[model samples]
Target chain A: MPAGQAVPRGPRTSRFALRPDERRSLGFILPFVLIELALVAGPLALGFYYSFFKVEYFQLTSFRGLDNYWRVITSPMVLGSIGATAIFSIVALGLTLTVGMALAVHLERDSRWNVAVRAVALVPYVISMLVGSLLLRWIFSTDAGFMAVVLGPIGLGDHSVLANPGSAMAALVFNAVWRDSAFAMIVLLAGLKSIPPSLYDAARVDGAGAFYRFRRITLPLMRLSILIAVVRLLIHFVNVLTFSLILTGGGPNGATRTTGLALYELGFVEFKLGDANALAILVFLFNLILVAFNLLLFRERRRAP
Target chain B: MTIASSPVARPWRRRARSRSAINALINLVIAAFALAPILWGLSTSLKPTQDILVYPPQIVPERPTLEHYAMLFQTGIQTPIINSVIVSVGAVLLSLGIGAIAAYAIARLPFRGKTVLIFFIVALMSIPLPSLIVPTFTFLANVHLSNSLTGLILLYSAYQIPFVVWILYSYFLSLPIELENAALIDGYSRFQTLRKVVLPLSGPGLVASGLFVVTFAWNDFVVAVAMISSGESKTLPVAIYGYLGFYGRDWGPLTAAAIISILPVIAVFVFFQRYFLTGMTSGGTKS
Candidate 1:
């Protein structure tokens, strides 16, 4: 029975028979596997399947091959939505990263006041996106809203930001940055915490200024965290729906209708399940490509270092 | 030691003082930017209907009133609030219950295809919710579970479990395995070691993962909006959205309802603020 000793074979066991540990492990993981297969994997495959056929009122009427995909690809509305999504995601990602990095650097120290400030900064993130968008919508409302009141002294009270196409898109980006910058800050702050204080001290002793220390010591060390935040925020902004839905309503002449909202309208509003599923698959692929691109960029940088 | 008394140290000390003051100022501005909309919403909710539309919007209302809050309840905001609570809590419980088991298996137990399972989970985490919405709705409808609180709970749990497993998997891996080994040597089975020894030591991990799941379930809008159509199963976000159509610029009651919807999440967040960063960064950083 000792290690490296051959055991006496009393009876041959079937190859299909699972060992005790395997059986227990299988039991432990079975429920989660079933849920994922049933809900996540199953729905994803079904959506892919539905994308190939004409679905009327949630019924598969006929196999249309790639017609649905072609229609989605060629649709002007879908093309416009993709353009809008690109603009929103790029701008929002930029602002969110900048603001989050600033906040993280400023509040990295552990103190009572800093803790309170961090909490306050995170308040917007904890609030639901729906409520946050609504709050911003109220603030930007031309009639009796906060922005109106603030701009009144400047003789711009009647000028509604949401009424203008460009500003409406800007407002959507602001809402995203307001809610998600704190998330970026939290991740980056963790990265900052992991760096040893002695490294900063050594740099300071070597006559490195603050900015120099940040460039030399912080940026390289914080690459992984920044990449993590960037990837997460990109995925979020690409897939986000509520900001456009509630804040701008894809409004001012559909200037802010993101792909997510387009998918929503196609599937729910127009009830074009086939077109929506096809678009859904397209958008999902776009998300994967975006994420993959970020990872690849980070990998390249990591290799250089 | 003599450098402390030199003139060179004076400017550095002065610079440090000014830098702290500057940091404080910047912190104030950032906090204000983060909280102004929320405070404005709260202020508007407390103002009288007429005062809400006043030209010089009162940061502090001239006549503060609870009329909006009362009206929100009168229109039956409580039903959606209750529904949200039940669904969120139920989903969190379900995700945590099964996610802990799966995470334990991946972290501690030796099993074939573990790496593949983990890869599948990570991939699932990135699947956009919009892509899954139409199909999930159809799937639930086919199974006769759509538009029900149970359906929402199940859907949310499925979406949330992958995240829960990822977080707890790292946490469990960080935990020392010697305790479980000791328990097993004391005549306990693997499941018993898991329940009695491992779980007892994983309090912080459970709390962190559970809090994340709760936030996800509570803040979700798209899935709930896609699935449920009736007022009977509406969550808080959908209900507040309904106010946009029903009230049509009635800011007072609308802000009040929005505030009501966020109260529970804010409260939980404030109480458990410490756990969130760990929960959030662990999964991302591990990758």
Candidate 2:
């Protein structure tokens, strides 16, 4: 029987009269819920459990309460990785948002040319991150790189970009922005599409200039999309490992080793499972805090106006 | 009124023309920025080894050769490509099969804890993959599924199901309930109604979600690298990563392998561009 229909007001017959529809709904969702619990939640809790233990070669030997967390907190290398990740995230996120918003605004019109340009913009994002990073690596190669050729006349051809710490980090950030700005553009473009053209028409009739209308109308309306883009990109930049691995290999004396690469090295390369798990938990908590901070910032801005 | 007759319109038209010209110039730069790297890679791939390292690198190859591509194929690039196809297609099918039903239920049925379930799925969507990689690896190893394509498929499916559900849930919600109601009134069961009525109308939604899942599975590098160790089982991205170590500064074959790895995904994206934009924007903006 369908839900919300009368049940004849009889005795508590059968003691579990789940309507047929409810039963079918339960059946439909049961497998999905089970898989999520088993795969996502179960492993997450297990990771927390593993973080407190002395794991060697993937085998948990003994429980050492808070020892792994303490070690991770005290390790200078881990701390340096966090700092590097913060720098990367900030620069990459800022560039991605600015470029994405600019592209979205310029290409918001649904013309044929706009459609084709939007597709081109997304090409890097659609390709595999490893491939994109490797392509950039080729472009930055000291010997036969595109940059070497382009900068040859300017006396910078022999300057090896990947061999320098500062430029290596910059290369990493550039790779991220090149790939992710398209994603941010897509999201922000959706926000732009939702804004009615009549708002612009009305503003023009009232003698409001383009900048004034954008500030008073578009920015206010795009707050959520901007927040979404920021949060998503921040999370991604903080945790992504491909660019560091493929483009720079965390090279130039470990200058570009982000937290994600550090975690991979800890768990897979060094076999320091306990330390990796602890660091992972810490990073996960940091992400939650970062997102919460963004939400609060946006909320405060909303309240101000 | 003619442009000559209206004095006020002249400067406005001139200004608009200048603005459009500037916009077109910016668009060209953006497009060039986007395409230059891939085009450079293609050019490098086609160039002979001697031509590749020539000073003032040739934007266009002097004598394009198929040697790099031939070398890639000779070394068995097809194995990883086939492995990637199997894993990606398997993950997409699995996620869509499982997510579609749950999404339909959440959209159409009245059930207890429905809102909580949705919140739970959304929360799952944000869990960082790095944090889960260690435990997931261990879990798969214990089950003896690590280093296997099936294991990769299962892991990818689990990772992508939340997104699939999110997109499909919005699609189902937007769909009119009357069609399902009509099916129900005709004495069809909920399952039959969903299969016969709802699923038929959700072709675009399925394609969009499936494309996203396939792309995620195909482009993934960290998980595949961590999980798979065997040569035959490695996916295309991981296999291409291996080229860095094996080729070791041989940009010709490396670029060729990279170009080959991205072809399938680029083709899929081009074909389904419209659905991709709609699905991505809608799914993201909805929640």
Candidate 3:
């Protein structure tokens, strides 16, 4: 049926078209819009608002203005969490990017082995972070852990990584990269696919070595994808909570306590609402800065084109 | 034959063979790195209590046992699994229904503020969820929604709706507008057209988005930990964490519970393997 064949008779005559198209569209959309605003946008605004006030046991007590922010900024735990988060994000992001790029490059072609490895690699991504952390705990456990069994004969027996602060942090970083690199691989794989093969072919025809072609062609084309993956991985790493929570429980003197875990303790465990809210806002600002940086990279790429 | 006898061709063949060998080596490492932890967990899950603590642990148990699995089912793990299923499925249904409709409006209908709405969804996608937990907890408590599965479902749907809109919006855009226009010419209302014509075409999109929502809601810990403290509404992830605390030395049942927690997720991934990859990658960076 052609649209022009239907005459615009009285709008009220058609029972199905009782309302105007605009109204009907609005009706279809308003439910989602209203619920999303109330649940998502509303809470975000409330987080900002709550940062300025004191609340105890689910009741708002008084407005503290900047005191909460002042205390949170000066708090050692907050500063420590910042430092921890920085270390975790840098190490995790670097490893994930390296591993993910390698996987993408090797698995870019269509082969049975590549396909199987790709499928298996995604298992960790789908598994809950909590469960993934648990799996790592078992793998790294001191008593009969896989690592223990593998390393026992080499005089590195009974090693409990989670019992030591530095090693626990390493465990956290390892787990972060393990779960997230699959995501990075998928993103970079798409980037590799998007690059015109003709560019590589042209370089080959010019007698460029494989390494030269990769450096001159693949790296430049993959720059944006790398940036995107870095930002996303940074966000996940910086906000990492469950990995530490379920694995190390921030043990061995707060070794793996990222800012996210600190916030969890503040809000849920200690009920320090004002401080928690202030810290939440601070984390949100940091995330916004990262996202802004990502947008800048994107804008620069667009301008170059 | 002349080329085959040439020294250059001999070196080239050797190089090609070595390159493939290197590729094979890399593939082996990748598979081991990815599957080692999970496979270890599975091995431990099947091991008896005595074998789990033995020195020079065997990669494959000599006598595989289902005792730990029986123990897992007999314990409190069941509640968390049930809770996870309810919240995840509820989130999938809620987000798809509401998000698909909104995506349709954005894709097909020329409504005012449509661009702004799309931008809003994008911005919402970037909001760090952990930062919002404090206020969300407070808000939920005030509304008597705290510690409830319903509240968790609502929050999960809200968090997932942004990706739903982003992915489904693209899916709907790829569809020809003329189809909807043709339905309109047949005197079918927009809602009827969407219900009768558009939905059948959006099956793949729905499956993709639904799979993502299920994975997220099921895998989440930050939200569930913040919102629900009691076993009444605690999810699998949180419950499994509690198991770690309680059974710190009981690797047998603990690993078994961990396996049970992840079994459904692995099933979904294996069953919808293609959609999961496509949806997640596409959702990673919008075109």
Candidate 4:
């Protein structure tokens, strides 16, 4: 867009000579860069490097190719944890998005109570995972959580939700959704607010029903937001560590063990640094694939529109 | 204009009376479904453990008492509210310093791989952290960094900086550039431009990042539990985690500890008023 010829010229260092503002910029960036080099990037890169070698007392014993990756795949506990993580993620994602989107739409429609509800909705989100898990653990405890008491008339009874594998996983997902739904709602609400009001007027004039208009106009317009919500929820589900770790310790009998918990066990508890790093790299790649998949879905939706 | 809370703008409001009644019914159902857990959490926190174990249980506490709250304050479990304050404040202060400089660079300075650097900051959000815990632990182990308050601060800062940079960077980017240019024209140095003009104008971003850093570090349990083994260095979440193992599954005290942990985060939410409104809704642009 600049009035330059097609030939790519060198960066205009001569014209864009360093000014006092630029010097200030260097001063600002210097410390943060040093910290990152020493702390984050260093750990991450070395984390990968150490995985290949037998890391013992700051020394790499020897580079054992593929051994770490193989251990992650073949180890029963680790693989089981991965399977549990997958199940936990999928269940939580489905429940949160459905419930969260519904709540967002409800808030958008029920404007009278919107502020009160929105504040309450945000309560769980702001509360530390430590707190929420603790609260829910008490409320859903096998003998006397409030959920059982509330559902008692309906014969649900006061069984500890965590005692049952299905319910334990359900409880974990339940607590997570309760907290995370606010985020999904916020994203969707932003999207909903952005839609042109005229589209609703146009739909009404055409005598299209509310459901149909929502299906045709709102859903279509919400594509980007929904995609974002899904991606966010996906990231949350896979990477979530605190809730599962605190609530269940992977489970009563590994019923609720997830890949994340497995990584912690392998790396810290078992001291399998290489295996944990390999698993972590795999989780990252796995997440990358999910993100790519969501993008692909977004592109397809755009093309169809 | 402030978006008023009125049903007039909603599509459902235009329906007939009969249809409206049905719509209200559906809305109530959804609201109740969503509000159930909050109500549930409140109920159990008020109930005695013996009453808690009663199946086909009472919905409300028969004798509503502060016993659970009392239990939470019991020793071997409680994270002294002051400890939570220390870590959360430390997190906010340190992360702000680091994020401010890094954000300043990305926002103002023209360096190579600027886009790449931005991407790296954003990418930190999506990376599954479970994987990192292992390597992080091992790395921490080598440096004798494990089991220290300093280690927890360092790791939390690492996590918080990327986020702080991101929120602040966009805000800094959006501020009018002419102020910095004008300061330069007036012969004030870049440092002066930042100190006087850029930084002052970008208070909202700083406040927002401050809120985020504080909230995150306050809520964090994983790093605290992993890095620090000593009771003195152990923060609130770690203390709460220890409560479970220590008390041998006493939900009353555990729930109490959990509530105590959140008071600081709540205070933070209330304190950073303007930042809370503008900041949280500003999602990290990863999506």
Candidate 5:
């Protein structure tokens, strides 16, 4: 029977009533169910299947079994990209969290100036990654670029930041921080707003200073938000491509090539379809590990009190 | 930084003055950090080629001109711009429509496996894009849907639906269930009740998710590059990449094109600032 024919039942309905509920729910959720199967699950399955076969010029050849995965894992360039991605993620996380926390605290007030400052902070978050990368390239360019113009009078104009390997990595980290810190601030600011003012008032009445109140009250309350922001930023910084791709082309002898950039090169430039697919699976596994850790933190939070 | 200064309270007047002074300085630095690159891009776009090449670069263009921007339109930039608009609008509409129905069902309908469904949606939001691009490209190629705007629209809507459901599901949860019950009792069908009652109340949520979808569809580079090979079907971001590939260090027109690509986002963001923040923060911390 159709669901409308039966009277509405409570949560403990019998097996017959339960059938109608399932049918009605399936009708409601069918669109999303179809979408996930085709777009997400299907693609992921194909990625795994493609990794086990050797393909040359878009034609699949003999089965390679574990050879593609083995080669990808042992390659020196892939190892270097993994190392670079880790360093980039850690350093970018540090800079973004520090700067974002400072901005959130400084601009937390609802005054006219503070509101305007907060609004100004979100400008970079909406701009396309391509646009942001291009803008940063122009800013740090050695030829009549802003950095060159400022550093020229100080006798430092001869060198480009992107020309040196170390500085290029630093520039990549800085660019990541610059692009994402505002988003961090938004999340952190939301956490900050949730803390009750009475807690701070109580702390102040006990002769505690601003530092004491923040250390004693604010930090503990803001831990969950910080974790969320950190996890989100880690995922983004690890996967970032446009900054390194457009600005430095992952160049200066491959110093700034992230795993994402490396994957692009493997798939597009070298046309090693099988190896690229293997690398893509590896990257997905890496992200899955991070997210699993995040879930652990979430469960721990839920179990508290 | 200011917290360190607040401990040594002198006279009230001195304390207030110092605190405000410090706040102003901090705000100035933050604003400059955010706006300086954009302003520099704008300035570079306005300068003639000679001024851009000169040493000790001028902060403001002495004689700003529109030649670079005019040159952009005088060329074939219009095609990619139109492609971007079509994809964004198409993706936003389809994702929001499909997502709304599913979200309403999840929120209101009594269902088994609902918890699992919600978990999958959240998990999908964090799935790395590069991992999927390799397989998605081959799949599209197999079906002969590659290098087409329809292909892009389909992919964008599919990828973005998780996010749309995430935002709208929360909005639906917060709405009172009694409203829906009343509508049902008044003899309105479930679909009619959603159209007449629930959707009108979720206008802010609709605008928020719509803006987010537009931004994602417009700003994507990896998916577009991997999916689109032909210039005729490329979106704005990929077109900008093409300019870099072909023009070889041409800054003037590059900056102009960059400016053009970001204008729509800036306009939408400024207008819907509150809704954007609410949607993002709620989705971030709560979900």
Candidate 6:
């Protein structure tokens, strides 16, 4: 039907009733399903298959069962990227959660400043990561960077975050937290709000310490929210591919080389189709593992009575 | 009752006395630290090129100017604002239309494989875009859609449909069925009932889904990087990034570009933030 077409009221009125004779709805979704199957499902399956076969752009080239997998499983460069991605993700996740949780707790008190804090918390998320890194590039500049020379003057002044390996990673982690912590705070704040005030009042009357209340009550209650936040952070960290592409360009001697950047280098830049396919498969498997970790955590919560 | 009379009842008093002071101090510090970059960005956007780097950089600009903002549009390179607007608006329309229908179907109509369909959509959460890079690029190129705003809108619409569909389905599902029954007796067809009654009633969910589509399309960088290469067709994020590459150390124009680039996203977020927040939490906790 057209946007405003009037339908006959007698029989067609019941869209919810059995439309046993109708195929239109099936037609509506069929194309979408086929495209998903072809584009998304096919590629993922083919990717895994290519990992088993010696493959390049258009050729199976040859069957090298377990060979590409072996290379990926052993390459120090691949392992190193995994390590970098892990550290980047874990540190960012930890800080975002902790900071978000802290902020959420503070705002729950309903102070007037809560509005200011909440607004500030959300602003950073609106900044595009590409622009965000560009800004950070300026802020961390040794020559004219404001961050090193200004706020934390004596301690951080003179040190360039991009030049050093540990600090480089720290800079990336800091950037991720700054962008995503707002998101976490938003989600966790909702979780906090869902809990009845009566519960907190009862805890206070029972003489629960702040620590006791948070540990025994807040943490457990926020499990689903925390799980969602972690999962979201993990996926975004995987795909924050642009940062390494631009920020450091996996620089300081590959100190910041992310898995995605390496794939781009191999697949697009170098035209190393085989290596790129292998790298993509590895990242896919790693992501699957993280997703599984999240589902398991959520399921465990559900299974508890 | 004796337990309450015991020290247990006043335990919060002791804990609060010690921790309240400490908590206040620590959280203030953290909030300030977390906000430092944004504050710095705002400060720097206000500064002139020379003052931007003044050693021990001044918190307040010695002399602020709109020079950077003035310089933003002076560039010969195309701004992605138009592209961003088109793609985001197009995506919002398409996603909401398809999502509303799909959600209503799932919410009201009983069908085989309904549960499985919802599950399939939810499972998309696992497939990171990076893993889909090669296939996505290949597909777009093969179809002659790469580098086009239409293609970008389609990409976002495809990616966001599942998320928006699932949630809107639930949001619509929870509305009392009597509304539909009343519409039925009033001689409205199912389609009319949906457009006239159901859609209007789910205003908050529509805002939530539409805003999400808008932001995801607007702030996106990765797919834009993979798909678009031409200077003429780049989105704001890509345009600003490219601008930075050429205009390095030109703080005046760069800050101007950053501020302009993010204005739409910020506006959208501020306007419907509550709906977005509630939508997100509903999807997570309702399951």
Q: Pairs clashing in candidate 5?
A: none
For model 6, residues A215-241, the per-residue Cα lDDT tens digits are 988888888778877886777786557
Error of 5 at A289 (Å): 1.7
Q: Write the per-residue lDDT of candidate 3 for residues A153-239, one digit (tens) a residue.
A: 987767778888988999988898888888899988978988998998888889999899989999988888788788767767777
Q: B120, model 6: CA deviation in Å?
A: 1.4
Q: TM-score for candidate 6, please give it.
A: 0.84
**Per-residue alpha-carbon lDDT of candidate 6 for residues B1-287, written as tens digits (9 for 90 to 100):** 36535776698667667776776676577667655655666678888877876776788777877777766766643457887788889889877887787777777765667756765666664467766675566556656787888888877777777667766887898899999989979999777888999998998788887877777787778778777888778888778777777887676677677767676677776777666665555332110
Query: How large is the i-RMS for each model, in angstroms?
Result: 3.0, 3.2, 2.9, 3.7, 2.6, 4.0
Highest-scoring model, DockQ: 1
Q: Least accurate stretch of 10 residues (summed lDDT) in model 1 chain A?
A: A296-305
Binned by DockQ into CAPRI classes (incorrect, acceptable, medium, high), candidate 4 is: acceptable
| Candidate 2 per-residue lDDT over residues A1-305, each given as its tens digit | 45677766556568567655578889989878888887777766777888999998778999999999999988988888888988999999999999999899989999998999999999998888889999999999885667777777999878889999999999999998898888899989977888889999999999999899989999999987788788777778888788898999888888999988888888888988788888888887886765565545444543644
Off by over 4 Å in 1: A1-20, A153-155, A291-305, B1-14, B284-287
Chain A TM-scores in order:
0.90, 0.88, 0.87, 0.83, 0.90, 0.81
Candidate scoring better on DockQ of 1 and 2:
1
TM-score of chain B of each: 0.93, 0.94, 0.92, 0.81, 0.93, 0.87
Question: Which segments of model 3 are wrong by more than 4 Å?
Answer: A1-21, A152-155, A294-305, B1-15, B283-287
Off by over 4 Å in 4: A1-27, A55-63, A109-112, A145-147, A150-159, A290-305, B1-80, B270-274, B281-287
For candidate 6, the per-residue lDDT at A146 reads: 67
Give the per-residue lDDT digits (tens) of candidate 5, residues B1-287.
36546756557658679889998998899989998999889999999988887877888999999999999899989999999999999999999999998999988888877877876776677776766777787677767887999999988888888778878988999999899999999999888988999999999889888888888899888889989989899999999999988776778999999999988889988888887785566332210
Cα shift from native, residue A208, model 6 (Å): 3.6
Candidate 5 Cα misplacement greater than 4 A, ranges: A1-18, A296-305, B1-10, B282-287
**Model 2 lDDT tens row, B187-219:** 998889888999999998999888888888888
Local accuracy of candidate 5 as per-residue lDDT tens digits, A81-106: 88888999999999999999998998
Error of 2 at A66 (Å): 0.9
Which runs of model 6 end up more than 4 angstroms from their true locations? A1-35, A42-74, A110-112, A150-156, A194-206, A293-305, B1-31, B185-188, B282-287
Residue B236's C-alpha lDDT in candidate 2?
Answer: 92
lDDT-best of 5 and 6: 5
Docking class of 3: medium
Clashing pairs in 3: none
